[model samples]
Target: MRTLRRSRSRPWPLGEPTSPDGQISTVDLLLVRAALHAGATPGQAVTALHDRGGVLDTTARRIAAGEDLPALALDPACPGGPLVRALAVAEVAGAAAGPVLDGLVDGVVRAAELDRLVRTRSAQARLVARMLTTLPVVGAVGIAVFDTGARTFLTGPGGLVLVVVAGLLVVVASWWMRHLVASVGRAVRDVDPLVVAMRRIGRPAPGSVGVPPTPGEGLPTVEALELLAVSLAAGMPLVEAMGLVARLGPPAVRGQLRRAADGLRAGLPPFEAFPEGLAEAADVIDISRRWGAPAVASLRLLADDLGRRAAAASEAAAEQLSVRLVFPTTLLLVPAFGLLVVVPLVVSAFSGFRLGP
Candidate 1:
């Protein structure tokens, strides 16, 4: 038998270096540079180089530029390097499996941002709840203490009765305050309707990632569709028209429209470019595609539907509030008012009609 020739493969490097503070060392930066030179993007290079820690965008870019990673890592602005390096390692692993690095970056970034928002909202709600619960209890105790001192200065049974009445009032007031605080806590815990509605509307379509609109930014979906229709009708390229709208429209709409434009640019069929969220308006998408006319007509119809739904919700909320108020006024307030006005008069009249023993 012929002797088999041994095949030799290049040996990989040993462990990467760490800073005195346990950050990426200079050697790691060189490795990242090598990855970039081998055709990886700056993001990919960072992902590939840092096998165990999170990588910052700035540091990643610097590594791609063949800079010393350890020096940049020590900069004050480059905080959380270890966590970033770990994330970068996961990113690289995903990429090595043929997934897109940019998608990973986008997902990680968006999730972090959303988590921050949730944390902030939770903190605010907690603070408000604490204040509502504490302030009333403190005030009630203070008033009760003051009333006890006032009682000490009085001597007669009438004065004792006054002190008891004041004590009773304080107890009742404290209970009321506790109830109010509980109600407020319940409200804080309950999800806001507007938040629910926005979340529903903002859910990304299949294969699409939706971005939140900036503050006071972005056109409504109807407006964006209308603009797209106009631009397309005027002979503008789909991609160019989308870019124009993104530039002129609100930030929320811009990111979405830009994504749609990207799909178009990437050679996705026009009908496929329709947002998944627009499935409820499928007929419009189909009709627009068939007629090649402005998509404005379909968008207008959808807007009408949205308007009607909004109006219905508003009407229902108002009707419920009115019904609730009516019961409270008629059952509680009216009886209380009648007792205050008519009962005293009847008692006085009865007292005047004395029967002889």
Candidate 2:
């Protein structure tokens, strides 16, 4: 029962979304795939898309209605920015839309899952930060409500000094914990510490989160594999693909890709062509090519696995964060509360005892 807009002279580009506002989303890809499977022409599929008002839909409509696809896709406003870049490369390189799109869909699914995992895993740490922050405000309000002399104590001899010290502790501790949480959370997310340090050196390019080539870890290898998958899917030779990767990948891995490409060109097998930590990705490409298996699918699976490992790392980091926050956070708050609320009430009570006697 889906409608098709077949009357348009140019059929919608196969596997390419017709455009709209800059809001491209994964759900848009799902819709496009569904429409294509349902025998809808590309134009009809664009018209059939339900996200007409979203970023992806708007961008898709623009592309369908004759806007420049590559320029628009690379525009910062493009929805599903990373996915659009992938599609743009496919369009430019004449890659088969089916394999490319299938890989893209899998990548998006994994990204969404990773996002959800991070949110769930970070919940407890965020909650603790929130609770600790609220204590000072709550203590202030409660003391004012229950203790009539609270006003006197706060405004009295050492009252101003007490107020200043307590305020400083609460403010400083809140700021410290917040900064720590963000830093540790980023570390868990596989964010590069070096890049974080270089934040003041001007912004990094968009969609540039290729893993830094840390020794022996999985992220760098996974990134290399995914790039190789794209090149192979585009029909590039392994040697040429490695060379392209060398030119385009993160600075940390370029030398490795270059050496691998040189080795490949020298008639070495992929397993031997690659450097330490990258041989596995090279082997994957070689084996998959030899068997004529879909390399894109294998790369997508590797990306999914890397995402899971990052999530696990984030969870473990959050657990450690919970332990680290306890003593420092608690000690700061407990003293402030005692000075601001408990000690003030106790002083007032002793004064009352003397007057009553």
Candidate 3:
């Protein structure tokens, strides 16, 4: 068995194997695929990364010339590392590499969509934050240096201190808010996860709508689904597919699926055999497969859902930021506005009244 497994993983026969914060541009992947289909070597494909004759293109050339393409595909830094890993596994299992690549392309498209949502939303938040930041400075300058009635009052020692303190607080608050928003954005993004959803793993589901929160949490589901899809495509039974993933998928979620596969083979209820979440997922996949839904297509849908979930997480983080901004904004802007705009008007009114008397 070990010898057979080793032989199967023996690097892909092809010469080569192998983010924005979330937009999906197929131009690069498409370019690579086109090159490969046209019989270009891995090195050749990478070198053809088009007008981008810089470090990236150079890196691709060097890797193709020097490193083992199959081995490098598993590296996190590799472009489409996860997809390459999937293709490698599919090749080993005797599945059609072309079909697997198609599945991978679908997954990448979904991931890109998720990235786009996160990036755009964060940018909007950043723009809003930036606009607010300039408020105190503009207001301060207007009152302190421009308004004649307020010139004397603002230039006084007491007024200068108020202006200075307000300016400092506003600056600090704006900086802190920007940092907080960025931190929140980073928090939502997770590195590639291992476990994937089952129903969605093998069967290509339809395009999903609306991204959900915490894409990382759903990745185990995506991993599981992708494994099942590949195994099923290769003609493995449901239990067999589950067992295969338990062995090959990320260690974090593997054991549970392994136990479930074992129990399932022994005639236990499918739902009772696996871990809670995985079991539910596995059960759904089992039912759907039996219902005649193509495993790959269904799994594709699952993958899309997971992508949406990631977008949702980013959105949630962005919403939380707006709430967080409230405290600092009130502390800085309100006081600055009142001190700059309201105070002068009140004082000027009183001064006019006294003169009339």
Give the winner by lDDT.
Answer: 2
- Indicate the residue-level lDDT of 84 in model 3: 41
C-alpha RMSD values across all candidates: 19.8, 10.0, 11.0
Model 2: lDDT to the true structure:
0.56
Window of ten residues with lowest summed lDDT in model 2 = 1-10
- Per-residue lDDT of 1-357 in model 1, one digit per residue for the tens? 000000111211111100012223334545554675587654556656433443334555566577543344323234333223222322322223112232233323432343244334334333433343344334434434554432233234543454455445434433443333233222311222222334567574332225442211111453344344444445566566665544443223344556666777887755575445334444575677688766645655564454334334433432233233343334433343333323333443465576888
List, residue by residue over 52-89, the lDDT tens digit for candidate 3: 55223534654657654445543433443344445445
> Which consecutive 10 residues in model 3 have the weakest lDDT in total?
1-10
Give Cα-based local distance difference scores for all models.
0.39, 0.56, 0.54
- Count clashes in each candidate, considering only residues at least 3 apart in sequence or on different chains: 11, 22, 34
lDDT of 2 by residue, 1-357 (tens): 000101111211211111121323466667766775676544344455534665456656676777654565435334444444444444554564445456556655554454455556656766777787668758877887788787678778786688788888888777666655654435532532223323433443233433332221224344456556677778887787777655444344455667778889999988898765564465666788799886667765765565565557656665566676676477787777777887778877776765433
Best by TM-score: 2
Per-model TM values vs. the true structure: 0.33, 0.65, 0.58
After superposition, the stretches of candidate 3 with alpha carbons farther than 4 Å from their true spots are 1-25, 36-59, 107-127, 148-157, 168-220, 235-279, 285-297, 308-332, 340-357
Model 3 lDDT at residue 93: 58
